[model samples]
Target: MFRVTRLAVPVLALIMAADPAVAQDPPLCAASSDTARTAAEVIAAVAEHQCPPGSRLRAAMTVAGQAVVLQRSGICAPESVRTMTIRPTPDTRALDTRALGFTCILATR
Candidate 1:
């Protein structure tokens, strides 16, 4: 029984990690309607805002003349990064992330 329990623990952990449904949800942030003019401003605003315990900061912004569509997460971290996605044309949609688990704080500039 002892040997079986030890093996089961690792197997369960692996299963949980592999399955999105079984995996823990990413932390959620409070919704905000604040807008920032630049990416730097957005980063700074997110950094300054405090997240509740166990939650993290996230922001989505549209900058004028910025060609790439960027999605940024983990905004509260000191070294947050942005992932770029190239669309056929610039995405001019208002930043709305409620359906993506958390509502993004900052939207279009």
Candidate 2:
């Protein structure tokens, strides 16, 4: 009886330890004042910084205290969507591209 009681206690704890509530809330990525700007706005902003076209821009943002990271969308010549991850940094602002493992280039096309 003593041995059975000890084992039962541990088994009960293991079963009760699992909580289903944690699965309800998942990490999310929402638009913020910074990301609130449109793709063209971000691209144009980066162009002012001399970023060349056909480049990639990665932005790490936080939403609801959760980090929502994404690459900027790119626009090709003739104004068509060629890429989904494209971010442009403004020329006037000194955004560090190295931290994102990518560099910001001007978009003339």
Candidate 3:
């Protein structure tokens, strides 16, 4: 009886550990919107502003049905491009205007 009890306990433990419903969700942001804004266009847009020389501008963009966070790093005058990286928050479900970097603009749909 003792041996039987130990064997049954192990079997019960194995059965309890077989749950398969736990799953993970996919990332909210995919590679689809990475190309929405080219580096050159961002630089040109910044240059058109009336800020001081060598100053930069922060622009917000809506992408792929979400409000993505955008940050402009530096100016690349020769290449007509500005280094910008987008940060998509977890709850960016709307296309409303939010502060992106230093400027607030509506994201593209």
Candidate with maximal lDDT = 1
Question: Relative to the true structure, how large is the alpha-carbon lDDT of every model?
Answer: 0.41, 0.37, 0.37
lDDT of 2 by residue, 1-109 (tens): 3456768888877767676653333222121123434344444555555544544443333221121112324322333222222344585146543111222322355
Q: Candidate 1 at residue 63, lDDT?
A: 49
Q: Each model's TM-score? A: 0.32, 0.23, 0.24
TM-score winner among the candidates? 1
Candidate ranking (lDDT, best to worst): 1, 3, 2
Residues 1-109 of candidate 1: C-alpha lDDT, one tens digit per residue: 3456768889988988899787664465553323323456544554466444345434444543321222343343323333333232233344432112123323323
Q: Give the TM-score of candidate 1.
A: 0.32
lDDT of 1 at 47: 49
For residue 94, give model 3's deviation from the true position in Å: 9.4
Candidate 2 residue spans exceeding 4 A from truth: 1-34, 59-74, 77-108
Give the distance in Å from residue 98's predicted Cα in candidate 1 to where it truly belongs: 16
Winner on lDDT between 1 and 2 is 1
